[model samples]
Target: MGGTNDAADGTYALRAVDPLIGELLAGLPALLLVGPRAVGKTTTAHRFARSELRLDYPPTAQAVAVDPDAVLRELDEPVLIDEWQVAPAVLGAVKRAVDQAPHPGRFLVTGSVRGDLDSPTWPGTGRLVRVNMYGLTVAELLGRAPREPFLDRVAAQGVEHLPTPLERPDLRGYVELALRSGFPEAALELPADLRERWLDSYLDQLLTRDLAMIGGQRDPDRVRRYLEALALHTAGVVEHQAVFRAADLSRATADAYDHLLRNLLVAEAVPAWHSSRLKRLVRTPKRYLIEPALVASVLRLDTNSILQDALLLGRLLDTFVMAQLRAELPLCRSRPRLFHLRQADGRREIDLIAELSGRRTVAIEVKAGAPGTGDARHLAWLRDELGDEFVGGVILHTGQLAYSLGDRLTAAPISTLWA
Candidate 1:
């Protein structure tokens, strides 16, 4: 129930990005942690910050709004500027500070919304290095370092090298994990009913306060309906027309809502993978609600409900797998890019693909139940198509066993994500 890497104060959980933050601090003049609100960005930044300038505080925000440079100059080195977006002028101040000294670890800024939305020209373009922060991943919840990306390891060493999982969740267990919600307060601290309320409140705040902060003025009811529609199609190649029709939104309003959701970090798109070697591949990106918990919350789905709907269960599982993979991305040495692959004819499809260095790829398929050789047929075909460019293929499933499906292919339990 408690995080393994809780800070001395017992209020913070050491995250997978903690080491990356330290590594970046040693050289970067400024570091910006960007993510959804209440995702623990402020808590994480507090760990390294010596002096604090919380722009969320009204007086502080007013001072920064009036004269950002003066407010910035008064703060000590390695200052934390929480909710810098509240007073967007601080970006120019931070930029100026970095230009004058060019010192590492001088500023640590946190923002709930995307930084670029407030300004026509971003002042921190070169001075600040942005690092994405997401909700607590299962690895972080368990207090595991996840020092190396599991997928990257599979790409490099093949599936034979996968560690035997210490814990393998059954189908029901996996469903619970998906519903656990990665938000620290929801996943770690709250009861089920309270957690549901917390999630609902989180979405409410996002639609009202957060949307207004980003200059998005729209009907909350319409936005919520749109969000619910998107939730139904989570982890699938989105059909814009169908979604808009379901939400009763016109094209222009739907696009605006889409932009707002993305800027708020509530929705994400995993782009379709395309290669010159392959033809008739679908280029539509798969849309997700950023985390499985949000999808479950938006749909008002419980464990029993999800278990009853096979299609919904599979999509949620995919979303769950994606959340874990996105968390592990920062740790990957090769810095792979994630994409979903599908052919126009629907003859071939890969749930996820990690394109490693040199355009080589590691393909993955997510299955709700134990996967057999047939489940890996698509992966094997991709392997054969790409030859040496294909590092390996894996069928991640709810099965308890890890075994070989064929050459350069294996079926491993989904728990290996955090193992």
Candidate 2:
């Protein structure tokens, strides 16, 4: 992360070194990089391979679609196949090639969408090791390191090593950071108007092209409306019927749309943390957009509106924290799974939860304003209820200090996500 250039231009930010990528490339025959569009999958894959075939190009797509084997036969070198989803047959070719002649690092496949059931490729299973990615994290964008991965830290010890800071992100500072686009092509460096236009175009492409590719006689206009409605519901637990009604989509159609978004990693379903230890834990998972800026783009909310709208700000602050934890979880040593916890009656709730092996779980409560002792009440309750299974709890706020609230409960600033 110290270097200004990542393999070349400064546009490529130094994403945290993912040991999974290294290990997969060394032992696996194919590595599939899956995520939403413009997530830097192609850019990251380019770093390791000399030979490449861009299936996104019309000519290449046609070639692979027509005869995937010939395309693979032509690539004798370790090859990078960009937008492999465009020609699902290429996946089959890669699988066949791997089986015919076993070799590590023979193929690097990048996809903007999830695997197509109709694709000619077999499940690959042991053949294709998948690595999920997202838009550049705040740490990567700033070219800095996170102060401490609170998720892993809390999982290891119960608030024993909570970082202390005299200053952190205040209210205004939090909004400013969230407003910055996580997409590298149109990040904070760009003017506000330009970034907005870029985001608009990105949505246009998704609705116009990618959505249709998922099947069904999908109407882009309807899908656009559905996505807009979905944006309004982001960062909260939603009933499928409510979502379908808002989007004017049938239940079956909504299921297909949900699958597509989930495949793209655009809509993260934060599963509700269930524990037999508790009396009653909600089973509904909260819906979250991949990045906070996407919320602004979809809802057409400007910076001024975002700042003035308290309700929107609160939901987005929660979504942004989810984005950060999701990005960091894979990089953490514990590799915990992120979840949400709430009572059916809404008596208690934790905005974010990270669960590791052996019932060890770290709970987080996101507050857009300064957090006080009361903010830690839910965390304290969870700790007491779960006992040793509860790794610890934290109140992540827009405050300026990191301090302990009580036993196994601490208050830390949101900015600590990317120190």
Candidate 3:
């Protein structure tokens, strides 16, 4: 994590944009990096290691185990082992290595899926630091342009001082991202249709291969239907009963499917933020698809229809804004906890709650068009309810301007949220 890892020299290096890099660089004696499929957990680990032993790859499992003393014995530094979850048994080996020589930044472990050990396993609690990695942020994708500094400027000058001018991503970029999805390699290499094919194949593999080993349900098709249903219901509060009806699944089956989605890191539920002693705050959490483009594609909601359709447009904007906030979380040295604010009278609702460090919070409303008083009505209500604890309220919309509605509200452009 400190010096550098030369093991990355010969590997295919995509632009290293993971904001978690700095945290992962400061590895404990043992650590685990977990994420959904194709989030670049393995490559990032290898790049951070001084040397690496890829246990999940061919031949190395035998090489590392049979000659553990030979493989890591002479090595006096951190060595990353990719996809370590595939061989959970080797964790005990790594644990013993740590016991013998407990050096910080010694073992960097990466895993895509989570599972249980058949036998009693070593608990490397304080010895390991856990981190989550995800797809490229818009900041990372913008390269070295003025757009690259959008969020940085907002952070420095405060939302009120943020510049109102910036060029936005055109329809082409939006279409490409929607069709291609966010698996780094597939996104970078393949054509749109081909990338869609790859995404479909990846989904199939997760369902047929990875999910089966989760050991609960024998049938994965049900899981597939539940996922599709969840995707369609993106950016809304989670209701298992509604999902049961939509997917034609039993209540128990729906619950199990939801658990599997979480276990697989395929979906996320954002809990409501109602710590107010006020008796009227809504406590039910909202659910969002982890990736915006995936939800758009699953719902076949490409193009400006997302801007024109009321319900679909709202969900799309909400999900995309959530993605932007998530991209900024690691950069701010915090975990992004998503939330929604609602009242019992159905009179007020804020779409996003960005909880930052020191309990400083920002309430954001997602909109499809220009920012207006109406767009920020709910945001203003939330600020009134939460008081000075509110960092500021923002209305994220499709417009190119970053104008302020008032002293407390800024209409932020979605493309510039992380510009």
Identify the candidate with maximal TM-score. 1
Best by lDDT: 1
Alpha-carbon runs more than 4 Å astray in model 2: 1-11, 17-19, 117-121, 145-150, 165-167
TM-scores for all predictions: 0.96, 0.91, 0.85
- Candidate 2 or 3, higher TM-score? 2
Candidates, ranked, lDDT? 1, 2, 3
Model 1 gets an lDDT of 0.85
**Superior candidate under lDDT, 1 versus 2:** 1
The lDDT values for all models are 0.85, 0.76, 0.65
Residue 128's lDDT in candidate 1: 86
lDDT of 1 by residue, 1-419 (tens): 12122445675666888888889998888998888777788788888888999887899999988999998887787899988888888888998989999989899999888836545578888888888888888888887763677867776687767765989999999989888888887887778888898888888887788888775567888999999999999998867888889899999889889888999898988999988888899989999988899998898889999999999999999999999898778778878999999999899999999998787799988998888888888999888889989888888899898888998898889999888
Global CA lDDT computed for model 2: 0.76
Worst 10 residues of 3 by lDDT: 1-10
Tens-digit lDDT string for candidate 2 (7-86)? 34445566654456666788877888776788677777877776999887899999898998888897755689988877
User: What local lDDT score does residue 174 receive in model 1, on the 0 to 100 scale?
Assistant: 92
**How many clashes in candidate 1?**
0
